[model samples]
Target: MTQLKQIKLIAFDLDGTLVDSAPDLALAINAMLVDLGRSEFSEQTIRHWVGNGAEVLIKRALSGTSVIAEDLDEALYLKAKPLFNRHYSERLCVASKLYQGVGESLAALAELNIPMAIVTNKPGLFTQPLLEQLNLARYFDVVLSGDSLARKKPDPLPLQHLVEHYQLNIDQLLMVGDSKNDIQAAKAAGCASLGLTYGYNYGEDIALSGPEFVADSLETLVELMNGSVTA
Candidate 1:
């Protein structure tokens, strides 16, 4: 594997790797459920259901647990999606917070003049507002949301788009995220991936997804990058 310093373009998964947006997501989901006259889900439940994107999260919320896409109630999902989007837009950063070392790690990477991009399963409507509200909009050179393309993570479409657009070699980029979708997408796109141990992986360990590197804190990532740069 190429060292982090050798990687020129860094693509990140927004929700778990960069910020802990689960609290805000939970609030929106609960409100949408209440509007639909359904019971609210706890943050813990919602957090595990998040990496798949808002639509899947809502489907899981409405169905009360893990659900196959084909098994979703189309009518209920159609009714609930708009409600969730509206509420999430209003509460974008109410309880969302940057994880420890995120700002520093980003800053260190920026100081190295590495171009960064964000590839998230979040839809553009919610993604833009959340990034703006959290002041994270400045760090990314490119932002690909769930709706930006026909396919999202675990499919590799988003990252492949970046590689083509930036004229980047697969080995020249590093995909950093907190879920299996991220690693799967990276591997499919032929890029190296780094997984965050503390981030949500649908109630599983991130290492099981087979990222090239795994760390519990972004500080550790910065250390790896710095060491590689100096070595």
Candidate 2:
């Protein structure tokens, strides 16, 4: 087994790893689809479409349907974005819940005084509300969203900005996420990454993303971060 190193700052992806937000997102997307006179998608399909932010999600939800055009309709997507946001705000906590042990793990990390931030592809509007709903907002020192920066994950800009903003040593930072975008961003920004087995990976196995470690559960992640787990 690879030896785990001491970590100082921990960054997390919000949607899949921290919260099971698919249900609320699915509900919002389906509501838009219904308004457009289009059929709704299953929760599983919406799960795969998440992690790329709201516009991409709307694109995926409208895929293979007449309501969506071949050429990317900026106007249509923009119009739909606010509708999704409005619907989601009402349904945010109706179905979304933290994965088991997430709250406890976060509390443990907080006790350690480890600086934490959220680096997610989710837009700030929905991300803020959802985190507030789950009661996880106070745990994060910084919340970097897709709309917060000029570029999103897989581009490394977000992580790079975070490292510079925090004045952190790359080796002391750990990025915890559930997808290749997270892995790629962490790698490019020269931070260690831990992938969660349960998050969305867009059909690819997360192991193939070459993260430094794979966390089976949030509890296991807390143990590893606290140095309770030996190599």
TM-score of 2: 0.93
TM-score of each: 0.95, 0.93
lDDT per residue as tens, model 1, 1-231:
234667889899999889999999999999999999999888998898889888789899998887656667799899999999889988899999999989888999788788899999989888877888888888898999999999999999999999898997888888999999999999999999999997778888999999998888877767777675233
**Candidate 2 colliding pairs:** none
Displacement of residue 202 (Cα, Å) in model 2 is 1.8
Give the residue spans of candidate 1 off by over 4 A: 68-71, 228-231
lDDT of 2 by residue, 1-231 (tens): 343466778899988898988888889889988877888888887888888787788877777432345786677677777788788878878998898889999999899888899999988877888888789999999999999999999888888888889887778788999999999999998888999998688777888999988886778777786678877
Worst 10 residues of 2 by lDDT: 64-73
* Local error of candidate 2 at residue 82 (angstroms): 2.2
What local distance difference test score does each model get?
0.88, 0.84
After superposition on all C-alphas, the RMSD of every candidate to the true structure, in Å, is 1.8, 2.2
Q: After superposition, how far is residue 10 of candidate 2 from its true place, in Å?
A: 0.2
Q: Lowest summed-lDDT stretch of 10 residues in model 1?
A: 222-231
After superposition, the stretches of candidate 2 with alpha carbons farther than 4 Å from their true spots are: 1-5, 65-70
